[model samples]
Every structure is written in C-alpha cells, then in structure tokens.
Target: MIELKALNKLHISSFYKWLNDSESIRYSLSAFQKTNSPDEVDVWFQSVLEDTKGLNLGIFLRDSEQLIGFTGICKISRLNKSGEYFIFIGDKSQWNKGIGCEVTRLVLKIAFCEKGLNRLMLTVSEPNIGGLKAYQKAGFTPEGKLRQACFRDGAYHDKIIMSILKNEYLKSVKA
Candidate 1:
C-alpha cells in the first residue's frame, strides 16, 4: 500500500535524485535541467514544508517506509479555489505497477475534500504516455492543449492540459 506523508529530512536525498533523473525530469513541467545541489533541495523542501496553500507530500511504502515518489499541488489560488497537480514516481522499477493510479486517487481526495478546492488541473508533456494514462484513469479529462508550449530536447513539445472539478470528482467517488 501507499501512504502520503509530510516531506521530511529522510526523503530529501531521494527526491533530489529524482529531480536530477533525466527520464523523470523529461515529463516534468519545470525540468531540473542540471544537477541540483543538496542545498537547493533543502531550500525546496523548506519552501514546501511551509507552504499553507499547497499540499506537498512524500509517497512512501507503508510496510517498509521507503520513499518511492512525491506528489502535490502548487500555484494554489485560494480566491479561485484551484490548483495544479504534479507527481513523480521516483523508483523506476516500480513503474507500471498501478501505484501512480493509487497516488492520483489519494491526491484527488485531498484536493477536493481536505483542501476544499473547486478545481484541480495538471499539464502533461505530450510524450509522457504513462503519466497521461494514469491521470485520465483517475478522472481527469483533457481540457485543452498548448501547442509547442515547452522547449525540451532540441525542439518544442505540446503540453496537454487535464482537469477535474470538485462536483465531478465527488460524484464519481459516490458511484
């Protein structure tokens, strides 16, 4: 099983490694293009640890307590009651095992229930097939696309936008 916990010191290095991992970073909107320093990671952890509007949680295995990935919402707008969703499964070997789906569900519950946000959205790079599939399965529908929105590799790539509203998510969970 997976659990979402507060981002703590023990998980910092793993998250930093994930930031530097080329394959993982490729799909991220803010790709860690270069190797980030430990100090930089510490700064990031501190910021997320203090953010009131955002939910930055570490994804861990329940039994072994191993930190596998992280997910959260940032750019939170209390006035608008909306936020953007972001997640990464740091363990490459654990990919395609349905963990991402579970993580998505758990995050959605928090966003719509605990945070009381009206809308949650995410941007997926066009080439990120697995991440796109997981988000769709968790109830997000493609809202639109930004053509050549991001410059990655040697060329630009499209970013697909997906979202779910509070009413839509709540109704789906009731069924």
Candidate 2:
C-alpha cells in the first residue's frame, strides 16, 4: 500500500504542514518545538539530503503516490554498525492501518541485511500505544525507559528505548 523513496524538494510543502500539525507530532520530539515556515523545512530537508550517515525516505501511497509520512535510520555509526530509527505518519487518515509495523520491518531489513548494521534502536513516548505495539511486532524489545523524557499535552511521559540486533532480525525473517 506504500512505498519508500528518497525525499525531494517536491515533498517540502506536505512535510511543512505535517511538521506544524499538532496532532501529527503529539508524541514526538517535534511537539517540543515550533516549525515556523516552509523555508525552515527546506533547510532541514537539505541537511537530510547531505547527511552521509543517515537515510531518510518519504512514505508515499502506492495508488495515489501521496506523501503521507517519513521514515529513517539516523546517526548511523560505521564502527558500531548501529543507527537510530524513527518514523511519523503525518497523514492522520493513515493511522492504525498496520503501516507502521510494515515500515518498521522494511527499515529493519535495510539496517541489518542491506547496510550490514549490527543493531537498530529507537525511542517512543510511553503514551504512544500504537507505536509501542508496532515496534514490538517488528521484533524490537524495550531496553529501558527514560523517565519523563518527553513532555506533551501538558504533561511528561516516559520514553522507551527499544532495539533489535542483526542476529535477532535475521532470525525473525527466517521464521
């Protein structure tokens, strides 16, 4: 139902709107700051394009080819063979469709099989129930929690640190 592609300038407008949408960023770090304008998004996009250690892709609907979200493995460490994974489905209409779990599996394949990475990690706010479930479905296990690490909706929430090792990912795919 969706495909991942390298984000281009054409996706800037949609990205700008998603970044500023309150509900879209409710459980993310984006909630803590403001995305003032499209220019700022353009700058951020440029940085993503330039980052050699990161891989950011736009999630597009297969039928309509609409840019609904983004996913990436960032802060990739060559020596350690690990990276931080993140995703956001900005289009609220697409929520709870199992897309998050599908995307997580795709990213896991890229990190462990394609990139030869040893591990992949991510953080999700405790209140993001869907995200927590999706990550678990993709074989990530909680490593720990950062108490009150995320503040949203007038309160603080724990941030769960989750990870999957390459060997674990390989075993998962075999089954």
Candidate 3:
C-alpha cells in the first residue's frame, strides 16, 4: 500500500533526483524537465506545501520505506468540487507493478472519504496509454478528449478527460 506523507526538506534530495531523471520527466507536464537547482527545488517543494487547493503527497511503500513515486490532486475549484491528478514513478523499474494503481486508489479514498469531494478528475495525454488504462482500473472513466491539447515531440496530442464521481467511486469500492 501507499500513502501521502509530508514532503519536507529532508526528502528533497531523493525527490529532486527523480525529477532530474530523463525517464521520469518524459510523461509529465511541459515544465517537468526544466532545470532546477537544489535551492530552486527547495522553494518549489515549500510552495507546493503551501498550495491551498490540493494536497501534494509523497508516495511511499509501507513495508520497504521506499519512496517509489509522487502523486497529487491539483487545480481545484470548489464550485465544481473537482481536481486534477498527477503522478510519476521515481524508479522506472517499478513501472507496471501495481503500485501506481494502489497510489491512485489512496488518492480517491482521500477525495471521497475525507474531502467529500464530488468528483476527482485528470487529463492524460493520448500518448500516455498506460496511464489511461491504469486510471480506469482505479475507478476513473474517460469523459472525452480535448483535441490537440498538448504539443510535444513536434506533434500534437489529445488530452483525455477522465473522472469518477463520489457516488460511483464509493459504490465501486464497496462492490
């Protein structure tokens, strides 16, 4: 299982190491691969900690004390009770090992059980086929695709909007 722990100054070293990895930056946002010094990362981490709309979680493996990845819900709008999810695995070797699914489940648990959030949502670039499938396994469904939502690698890619309502997620979890 995975949980969202407080990311403090100490965890910054390993976390920043992950950010610098080429593989880790590949599927993330446009600024994912941008340069950042240790000081810059310190500031960024502190800023995310202060973000009011969403919780930035440091994903950890319970048994091994491994910092396998990071995941968070961002861009929240209270009127809609909606937020976007972002996740990245630090150890590329851990890919497709079911940890990502567990992390996603934990986030939904927080949203439905604690936050009383009506809807949890995310947008995955069409190129991120694996992410789209993993999200569905974790209770999200494709609402639609935004045409040419991202321009990367010299080509335009669609952004797929996916969401799970509190009722649907709760019912699925119970079943």
Clashes of each: 0, 0, 0
Cα lDDT tens digits for candidate 1, 50-151: 888678888899999999988899989999999999987888877888988998899999999999899999999898898888888889999999999988
lDDT of 2 by residue, 82-115 (tens): 9999998989999989888888888888888889
Global local distance difference test of model 1: 0.85
The digit string of per-residue lDDT tens for model 3 on 1-175 reads 6667866666777767877886776677555656467777677777877887787888887887777777888887778887887887887878888988888888888887887789988888898889988999888999999999887677888999999999999899889
- What order do candidates take by lDDT, descending? 2, 1, 3
RMSD of 2: 1.4
Which scores greater on TM-score, model 1 or model 3?
1
| TM-scores for every candidate against the unseen true structure | 0.92, 0.95, 0.90
Off by over 4 Å in 3: none
User: Which is better, 1 or 3, measured by lDDT?
Assistant: 1
The lDDT values for all models are 0.85, 0.86, 0.80
Tell how far residue 54 is off in model 1, in angstroms: 0.8
Report the alpha-carbon TM-score of model 2 versus the true structure.
0.95
Off by over 4 Å in 2: none
Error of 2 at 154 (Å): 1.5
Top lDDT hit: 2
lDDT of 2: 0.86
